[model samples]
Target chain A: MSLLDIQDLTIEAKQGQGRQAIVDRVSFAVPEQNIVALVGGSGSGKTTTGLAVMRLLSPGLNIVSGRIYFEGNDVVAMPEGELRRYRGKQMAMVFQEPLYAFNPVFRVGCQIEEVLQFHTDLTKGQRQQRVDALLRQVEIKDPGRVARSYPYQLSGGLRQRAMLAQAIAANPKLVIADEPTSNLDVTVQARILTLFKKLRDDLKLTVLIITHDLGLVRSLADQVVVLSSGRVVEEGPAGEVLQHPRHVYTQQLLEAAK
Target chain B: MSKDKHFVPSPGGLRNFRKNPWAVCCLIILGVFYAGAFLADFVSPYSYQNEDRSYSYCPPMEIQFLDEEGRLARPFVYGVTISFDEFHKRNYIIDKAEKYPLKFWMKGDTYQFLGLIPSSRHLFGVDAPGRLMIWGADARGRDLFSRIVYGGRVSLSIGLLGVAISFTIGLLVGGIAGYYGGRIDDVLMRICEMFMMIPGFYLLLALRAMVPADFNSVQVYFSIVVILSFIGWASLARIIRGMCLSIREREFVLAAKVMGLSDFRIIVRHILPHTLSYSIIAIMLSIPGYILAESALSLIGLGIQDPYASWGNLLSEAMGIIQINFSPWILLPGFFIFLAVMCFNVIGDALRDCLDPHFQVDENI
Candidate 1:
């Protein structure tokens, strides 16, 4: 069974007196223990779709009609109380810019521990232990030192890893990464892709990556869903989709990628 | 590495403030007044209500350390004999024949120390018939100095209590309105606007007028505090709401929401705390307003009544030109009010400068 089934989802933004659909009838599924890349160019509604999956869409943006099923439960219709439980525990997200994502005032460890604190019943000592362990799992050298430093104190790569640690602290069923490698260097991006692969294989974790980077999809994604102007243009195995483009927009996107 | 400079620690931290000499001086000045107000019962020679009607409008007694033979002696003041003037106003003539020496820790009016310990030992007092009226006496023959000290308790504490009550409401209201923007924000902002629309002084007077006149001094003091606080929070809430609107858009706030922390938790922990540095500086500046509000109410006879002095009611004695001409010392409470307000403004300005750079960083975001 699919870990997450987003069927006929339509999202609208307020424009003048009428509402405009940003994501129109987009349907896709993230299978268990698989990496699904929702690939698209800018303004493709990829980020909005990712946010809708977590019900984290900003004000003025509304889910006009859709059902987001996570473990057979309709996420769009879930009550706030239960949705809160689903977030950071059953499903988690990592944003693009770790520097901005983490609270600047707090240390790396404290931010990660906040997720564990809310989702798990771990004691303070156990939570601290879990935080250090999570940091190590992200292949961060000197977990204690990195944990003690504030988000701004660390390098961009280290901050992103810390953010990833926070996302997986609750051992979530699915991790949604929104343009996670867009803000990092080429070397750091390669390492991050390797880390994502390790997370999928070792932890048996499902990941839905929202990005326009074809290179990232080629290296990391197993399944591909190509989106163009709020609609799904193509979907197939990542190798097939990248090798033989079925849609004109997909062909243009591949040309732009090169 | 250069980003480290941009993302420094707390902007309101005292590191910059301590280097500013004027800020330190203002802090010390405020400290002394607060200390005097806190220990008023023990520091003042006479109780606030202990008045000798015969000594009404008496000039300040000068303490002499040299005796008749020009030899050094304990501080003493001669007795003052009262005489009626041409206009039937009482005049005080110094009678050097009777010399009364002052003593420290002297037993005077017996009262509870801090409402915990029973004691009558005053810091300094003169013998009977020779009063130690340092700042002279008011129209009611009460020591002006002692009244100012006692009045400081009401005047200084009203500001603190009022700010505490108002800021709590302001921060919470602003945080909630800003965090969950939409219908809630519209309703709260309009309510805030309604409050801000009314002139503060008129609102203060109208609210003060609402309280029953027969309430005791304690009740009146609390009501006045509540009135000032009610008028005070509206503006602060509006400012805080603006700040939260910006802060709520910061990525960290969104991250907190994604963490599944409840709305209240996010508001208080993430959103509200980001506005704290601004709130604290604002609090320092606004305290003087509360103090002045209390004084204004008391001056108008709508605040703390007589026998229990506040700086405003104490200044009421100097309203007449004759009182100002004959016994100018009656205006001493006005001087204390000026000093307190000046000190608070100086410190608040210094804090703003110290935290100004942090605000620049925030603006960059």
Candidate 2:
């Protein structure tokens, strides 16, 4: 069975007098131990869809009608208290900017430990060890130094890795990364992509990567869901979809990437 | 096994604060004043109520370190002979014939130390028949230096108590309003605006007027604190609310929300802490206002009554031209007020710089 099944999910953005659908009946799924790239240009509702999967849409945006199933439970219908149990433990998210994602005041290790504290019954010592282990899992050279430093103290690549460490700290089955590699340099981006593949290979982790980078999709995604405007234009295996474009928008996106 | 061995916790702002010389200086000055306030009974030679009417309008008696032969001697203060001037005003002339040597840890007035331990020993005092008025004597012949020390307890503490009360209310009201926007924000922000619309001084006066005439000095002190805090919190609430509104939108706050941290946890631990640097500066800046407000009320005979010293009530004796002209030492309380206010502002400015994220500490550390 698929780890996450998002079916007929319609999200609306409230503007002045009327509500406008930002994600129109968006349907997608991520199988176990797979990477699904929700590819789109700016304002294509891919990020909104990702946010909806976690029920974390920004204010004035509503899930008009949707059924977001994670393992069998409907995320859209789950009560707040129960949803909290699933978040950070069963499913986690990483944002586009690691510097902005991490609280500036707290040390990065404490932030990763915050996830472990809530999700696991680990003692402080164990959590500290776990934090170091998680950082090492993301290939951080010195977990101790990176953990001790604040968000701004680290390099961009290190911050991104720290953010990934925080996401996978609780051993969440799925990680929804919203444009995770867009902010990094080409070398760092490739390294982060490789880390994601490594995570899936070693931990059997599932990822729903929301990005506009077709190159990232080609290198990392097993499945591709092309979004144009607020609707999904094409959905297929990444190799088939990239090799033979079915939709005009997909063809145009491929043309633009070339 | 040694996971936290190399974990050096980040210095939030203390390193920057310590590097600031002016802030450190101000902090020391404040420390001295606060220590004096706390140890008033033990430090002051006389209690706040102790007075000798015979020594009225006495100027600051100079402590002599040399005898008539120009040889070194113990510090001593000469007795004052009371005489009437041409206008029948009491004039105190130094009686050089009679002198009393100063002694440290001398037993003078018995009082509760920290309102618990009863003790009579003072830091310094002169023998009976010669009073050591270091800052001079007021119209009531009360030691101005001792009164200032005792009054520091009230004037200094009121600032802290008032700020604590108001900021507690301000932070919670502002945090809740800012975090939970829409209807709650509208109601709270409108209430804050309504408070802001009223002139604070007039509101203070109105609140002061409401205090029953029968309340004792302690009751009056607390009532004034409540009044001052009530007037102070509205503006702080508004400012904190504005900060919260912006901070709630920051990506870190969003990330915290996604972590399934409860709204209260997010607001308190995450959102409120972001506003702390601003709040710290605001708190430091506002303390002076509380001190000045209490002084203003007491200056007009509305605050702490006579016999019970507060810096404000102590300055009340200087309202007359004659008092200001002849006994200028009565205005010494005003100088103390200025000193406290200036120190707080200097520290506030320094703290603002220290708390700034861009404020760079030394790289060698």
Candidate 3:
């Protein structure tokens, strides 16, 4: 059985005049310990699809019709309380802008510890120790130092790592990273990709990496689902999809990648 | 490993605060005022409402003593001797020292300290008739100094209480409006605007007039606080609502929501904390305005009345030309009013620099 299954999902956002559907009949499944890359251009609804899976869509955006099954539980049908229990612990997400992802007022350690404290029965010391270890796992050189530092004190790469550390702190079954490395330098991007690969292998973590970069999909994703204008243009094994492209949009995306 | 293991102290906000001297100075001034207000009984030398007819119009005392040679000493007035001038005008002098030594906690008139502790410690000696007017006499020869102290108890406390009431209501209303933007936001904002449209001073006056004239000083004081708070909250609410509107969209707030944190928790923990630094700065800044408002209302005789030593009431005595010409010290309350307002503003700015994230880190740092 798939760890996460989305069947015939549709999401609509209320824009100026009428309800414009952002994600139309999008469907995919990720088995346990697999990395799936949802790839598309800006405004292609790839990110929207990820948000729908997590049920973290903005206020105006409505999940018009969708059935999301995660670990044999229908997410759309679950009560808010049950969904809350699964949100940070069962499924976690890393936002695009790491700088804004963490609260600037609080130390990075406290932000990570909040997740652990909320979901687990850990004491203050235990939570702090766990946060420190997670920071270290994310290749933060001085975990204690980074833990103590505010978000503004850290570099973009460091902030992204801290965010990743926060996401994985609760030992989530599925991790959704939305444009995780889009804001970083190319070199930092490579290192982050390597770190994500390492984390996935070590923890047997299922990851849904949403990005516009097909190169990232090629490098890290086991499977790829290409979205265009709220519709799935192409979906297949990452290597096969990239090598033998069926859709014109996929070819254009590949050309853009080149 | 060594690089990772090395100690790196998290820089403190104080280091940032030091970079702005103006803020530090303001903070110090505010600290002084707060100390003065809190320790009014300790700092004040006389009862706020005490009267001394003999010490009327006495020039501030200049300490004098006998020389070693036992000569009449270098022309030092001993104690104040109030008398009529050749023009039959009231005059005073330091009657050469007759053992009117400064005293502490000497039993005189009674006062309820903080509405709880009952004590009789004037911190300075009373007059011959047990009246201790440190700042000399008012129109009726009441202690101006005592009134100022006791007046502060009303003037200063009104700002805080008013702010407290306004802040609570404003935060709730504004927070709701900002968080849920749309028709609901529009409706709330329009209501806020409606409140804003009413002439604030006139509204305050209307509210003040509604309170029964026979209300006691405490009731009157409380009513004024409520009135000021009612008028005051709209501005703060508007501010908080605007803040909430922006902060609600912040990534941390979105992150909190994605973490499955409750709406209330997200609003309180994530969204509210962001606005607090600004709100605190606003509150501090707004206090002087509140105090000044209360003072003005009291001075106009619509606020604190006679037997109350509010700076406003003290200044009310300075309204007539004769009092203004005869005793310029009546204007002394105005001086305190200005000082208090300036002190609060400076302190508020300083706190903004200290607490504001934008102001905390200097360019050089």
Candidate 4:
């Protein structure tokens, strides 16, 4: 059975005078442990689609029509209470800007520990232990020191690693990484991509990666969904989608990615 | 793996607070003031109302003793005998043979320590009947020193009570406005603006004018506290509302909401604590303002009236030119008021620096 299923999903943002549909009748699915990439340029509803799945859309922009199913449960009809439980546990997200993703005031360890504390029945010591392990898993050097350090005290790569550690700490069933490496340098971006690949294989974790970087999809994703102006222009295996030009927008996005 | 096994202290605000010297100094000063206020009766030598008519307007006395030489020893005013100063055309004093021994923790007039424990011990000697005005006499010739010691009780208590009232109102109103935006925010903020638009001083004046003249001193005192608090809360509410509006959108707040935490918990546990540093700093800064306002009102005959000695009521006597020129000691209350305000401000600044996240501490860390 598929882990996630979205059918004919549409979303609109209420502007000053009119409602603008940002995501229109997009559809996709992720099988268990599979990696899927949602590729598009800016304003292509790539991020919005991911947010709609998480139900973390901002005020005035909402899922206008959709059926999102997760493990046979209707995600679109779930109460806010149940949706929150699903987030960071059943599913987790890593935002585009790692700097703003984690709270500046909280230490990296505490931010990760919050997830463990909320989603797991682990005691304080156990939660701390889990956080340390997660940090180490993300290739954080001196995990203890990094755990104790605030976000501002860490380097950009370290902050991104800490955020990823937090996202994975709850042992989420699906991890949605939204342009995770967009803010990193090339070297750091390569390292982060490798880390995500390792985590996905070792833990048999499903991942939904949203990005404009075709190189990332080519390297890691199993399937790809290409979107433009809120519409899915193409969908197929990641290798086929990248090799053959099925849609004009996909070709444009591929050209831009190069 | 072993390195990740141990507990590590987060290097952030807590560590910074510990290393901040100015915050430490402010804390120490504030601690001393609170200790002094709490232990005033135990630490002061005379009762709040003990009278020594002979020593009225006497400059702070220096201890004296007869040397073996038997000549008049180094500069000490002899205990004076009350008599008429015919040259000055007023009652004056003559040097007496006996010195009034300064006492400590000696039994004097009784008082309720914090309105709880009954005690008679004072830190200094009581004045002789009708005098002993270390800070000079009020209109009734009551000792200003004792009044001040006692008045500290009223002034500090009123500041605290008023702050408590203001904080409660501000938190609730601001929380609502911030959590629920749009029309609710608009309506509530409009009310806040309306309150802000009113001339505070004139409004206070009008409120004071409305108070019945027959109301007792205690009633007037409490009423003034309530009035000041009511006026003060609007500013805090507006500030907290703005803070909440921004904080409510924070990911952590949304996370809390997703966790199914009640709205009240989100406000009290999460939202409220974030505003605490600002609120506390504001409260500290506002206290002196409240004190000064109450003092001003009293100085103008609208606050605590005579027989009830606030720093303000005490300074009211100085409005007369004769009192100002001849007995400048009457202005001593004003000096103390300035000292209190300055101390609070300095302490508040220190706290702000301490609580602020930007202040660097332990650069090596």
Q: Candidate 1 at B261: error in angstroms?
A: 2.0
Clashing pairs in 3: B48-B146, B78-B95, B78-B96, B78-B97, B79-B95, B127-B131
Q: Which lDDT tens digits does candidate 1 get at residues B222-294?
A: 9988888888887888888888899899988888877788889888877887776788899999999989999
Worst 10-residue lDDT window for candidate 4 chain A reads A97-106
Residue runs of model 3 more than 4 Å from their true location after superposition: A13-20, A77-85, A185-191, A201-204, A251-258, B1-30, B52-77, B80-99, B103-123, B126-134, B210-216, B272-281, B346-365
**Candidate 2 local lDDT, A146-255, one digit each (tens):** 99988888888999999999998888899999999999999999999999999999988999999999999999999999998899999999999999999999999999
Against the native chain B, each candidate's TM-score is 0.95, 0.93, 0.85, 0.83
Docking class of 3: acceptable
Question: What DockQ does each prediction reach against the true complex?
Answer: 0.57, 0.30, 0.31, 0.09
Q: How much native contact recovery, as a fraction, does model 3 achieve? A: 0.48
Off by over 4 Å in 1: A17-19, A122-126, A243-245, B9-13, B127-130, B358-365
Interface RMSD of 4: 7.6
Predicted model with the maximum DockQ:
1
TM-score of 3: 0.84
- RMSD (CA, angstroms), candidate 1: 3.0
* Model 4: CA > 4 A from native: A116-127, A201-204, A243-245, A255-258, B1-35, B51-77, B84-90, B104-121, B126-133, B139-141, B164-180, B202-226, B239-284, B297-309, B317-327, B345-365
Q: Model 4, residue B305: what's the lDDT?
A: 76
